[model samples]
Target: MICIHLGSATAKNLIEIAGAQTTVCLRIALAGLLAMLIWRPSLRIDPRAVPGIVALGAAIAGMNLCFYAAIEHIPLGMAVTIEFLGPLCVALLTSWRPSNLILAATAGVGVLLLTDSAGTASWTGIGFALLSGLGWAGYIVFGKAVARHTATNDALALALGLGTLVTVPVLLTRAEDLPLDPWFLIGAVAVAVLTSLVPHAIELNALRRMEVSTFGVMMSMGPAVAALAGLLLLGETLRPVQWLGIAAVVGASAGATLLADRHTPAAPETPGEHQPIRPTPSEAVPVP
Candidate 1:
């Protein structure tokens, strides 16, 4: 929803509003504040985890940078279609259910139709979007491990801290583009709230109570959400083929979730175990 609104507003005031690089830098700043307030990590450092944290931070920065760049060159919808591959890959690697295979195919068809639309988006934009997706996938894997090793709050704070450090040089290079208008700053804050803070909080809360596979299946609805957001907020209408593609991905995702629920086993009694039980080959678990 924030992305939709931001995109619309930016479209109107591209010159007045900060570009993607500046907006993302503000997002990092806001995220850093939120994480610090929530996590309040100790000054004590873990040397072993620093490399992983740094890598995750770089990936996050790269994903945002590339995504913004892609949007500048292509339609917002198409850019998102390409970026969706990141989470899709994460979901695929973590689960091998036959139903999920169908889900994957469905999403693939949707992406194909979405990108093949009238805009004739450049291969460079698509390539950048793909790179962003890969970065997102990396972010998820590393983030999960970090969360496991430390508190979610602490891990996120540390990750953001690292991200800030990594992004400073880029931010410096783009400093001249930083918006001086108070409204632009406000808009940046709004974007951070919607895109960074809200989504992260919601996903973290949801993941705590649900399985990763289940989360992935649910996230398959993102394109539909983005489309709706585009329509309602940006007055960007989708064509019939695009609508069909959205249905395919959404349907497959829902189907996968249902199938997984049927196959998951009852919980074991290890009360102290940090992680949830891994679903068996034939087992599926419902979102709690």
Candidate 2:
């Protein structure tokens, strides 16, 4: 989470100069190339894995684009809070117990407080953030499916590689805005490492361990983390109410973590949510 926000903050300066399309294109493109180099996915893969990888790729590509565009229009924390609604819904709908709704509502009310949708321009940011949420939901769903099939991050590497395709048009269109200097290259690489490479690698691994709802509940920390990133890195400020909202979000995540029962049966698979996916035997070798 810290890395992701750090990347967002880092990307902000680049976005200011290059525009959101160009900055995000560079970030994703570099990340994809690096991941492909690391994993070197086989030319042949499981046919069953294709849909999940494709969907995950599209989701990741779309989500980053929307989020980058939104941060250009609004504060990073606010954009993240709005974008969180996507996974929050996945948690609620996939939860078997009625009690989880309270957790979601607690987080929801907190986000409502953080959100200050007043002007047309702010609404435009909110609109993009909302779209990012949908893409995020797609990520949680398809990511789980893909994770179940792969022992390592091969699937993720491929998905990211495929996602680069989505950036081609954006890069071409924004070619005029892109900086050709070495400093820009350094910044773009940093953004890719912090945001796309680190976060996705960790998240895909986490999905391999826990249920989607559990992961979603835990991800309630995103807004608070992003807010801190905005304050410390971007010099953004939050109102007292927004601070309260952050507290609520943080508290909810902690509460959910403390209260979760490992033995609890996860809700059965829905479209975006899934039954607990155990790692394949290749992935399940006992830790030495």
Model 2 C-alpha lDDT per residue in residues 142-182, reported as the tens digit of each score: 99888766533677778889878778777888788888889
lDDT of 1 by residue, 27-109 (tens): 77766765566456665645655666677677777877787777666666666778888878777778767666667767878
lDDT minimum window of 10 residues, candidate 1 = 279-288
Write down the TM-score for model 1: 0.80
Q: What lDDT does model 2 reach?
A: 0.81
lDDT of each: 0.63, 0.81
Q: How close is candidate 2 to the true structure, as a TM-score?
A: 0.88
Candidate 1: regions farther than 4 A off: 1-16, 43-51, 205-213, 265-288
- Look at candidate 1 and tell me the lDDT of residue 170: 74
TM agreement with the true structure for every prediction? 0.80, 0.88
